[model samples]
Target: MSEKQEPSIWQGFKAFLMRGNVVDLAVAVVIGAAFTNIVNAVVKGIINPLVGAVGTQNLDHYSSCLSSSCEGDQGIQLMWGSVLGATLSFVITAAVVYFLMVLPMAKYLARLEARRKDQEKGTEATPEVIEVTELEVLKEIRNALVAQRGSGHDER
Candidate 1:
């Protein structure tokens, strides 16, 4: 009696790591980290300066005290400016990724899918092709049966 053995843990791990999605995810994470630097630079260099025209250039410094007669580090300070700066950075990053990467890739994939469909349609068998194939199959079956019967008669 033979027993079937399950795959080892190492083999399963290797297979998981070798999947296309895992590699793609790793690449995306690396690229995203690199892209984040560019987005942060844009926000600090351009957006902060523009905002500085109205107030201070440093968003971290902008805050509001919620309590009256509050001394150093003794009040409810709402750092809305920093939140705004972070939000702007996120929005810029999203826009850049969508327009530059995601949108173009989607369009390219759509074009490829369309082309594939067109090729499939072009290669599809017509009624005449089907008829000819059926006829050939029938002829082969008839010849096979005839040969089988002739061999049986000889054996007898």
Candidate 2:
């Protein structure tokens, strides 16, 4: 009669918030936002002109109409290059994080978790109980044969 019930919606939400991964994700997101600012500056100040010289950089600023009424209008566009640069920066940052941080961390954590689970299961084969390596067994046999020959000559 005292069985535990499934968690309520709010309780589930609280549990989600308390999870280690959720907290880690929040931190990573904050750092990533800050990182984006740095990357944007690097691209705009350093990389953009280099890339622009290669003709791969988007130089197309803005679409404009040349109608008589619009002759005096200038489509001011420092924003587009910054926007494009920011997009490239974001992609590069995301790739670096995925490869360097998230993927390797996930793999290492999984390996450690698997080892913990194996230890908990207590089904791991005992190293002492297992047959010795082939090299060790061969070395022991060789030593025994050598001893036999040496003893045979001594007995004679």
Candidate 3:
């Protein structure tokens, strides 16, 4: 009798890391993180200045004091500008990802799927003539003999 050897923890971990999904997810996370900086910069350097053309230079400066004694001291401030800036950043990031990455990738995958289906259809369209095996012919003969015997019509 032979004993089965179980895989080690390190081997299991390596297998998990080598999986396509895991590697893809890791790459996505890294790229997303890197892309965030560019989005933030665009929002800060371009959009903020564009929006600032009408008023303050920086969005962070656009805050409303909530407390009554808000003058000359640090009071409760509603930072609506920062919120707007963050929202703009998020929107820009989403738009870039959708238009640049997601849309192109989806189109490519669709083309691949269509091509694969077309190839499958092309192959299926060409009908092949099926040849019966010897075993099938033998089976039919055996069935006929059995039926003839049951009906008491056997010829010696």
How high is the CA lDDT of each candidate model? 0.67, 0.62, 0.66
What value of lDDT does candidate 2 attain over all alpha carbons? Answer: 0.62
Error of 3 at 114 (Å): 0.5
Give each model a TM-score: 0.50, 0.39, 0.50
How do these models rank on lDDT, best leading?
A: 1, 3, 2
lDDT of each residue in 38-117, candidate 2, tens digit only: 66676666666776787666634544454434434554323465576567767765665566655665555445545655
RMSD of each: 18.1, 20.7, 20.9
Candidate 3 worst ten-residue window by lDDT? 123-132
lDDT of 1 by residue, 33-143 (tens): 998787667666776677679876557767888988457888788898899867766786677666666566555544554555568888632222111233544455456
Record all residue pairs in model 2 with backbone atoms less than 3 Å apart, i.e. clashing: none
lDDT per residue as tens, model 3, 52-126:
787665566677888876666667888898987677667866776666665665555445545656698884322
Better of 1 and 3 by lDDT: 1
Clashes of each: 0, 0, 0
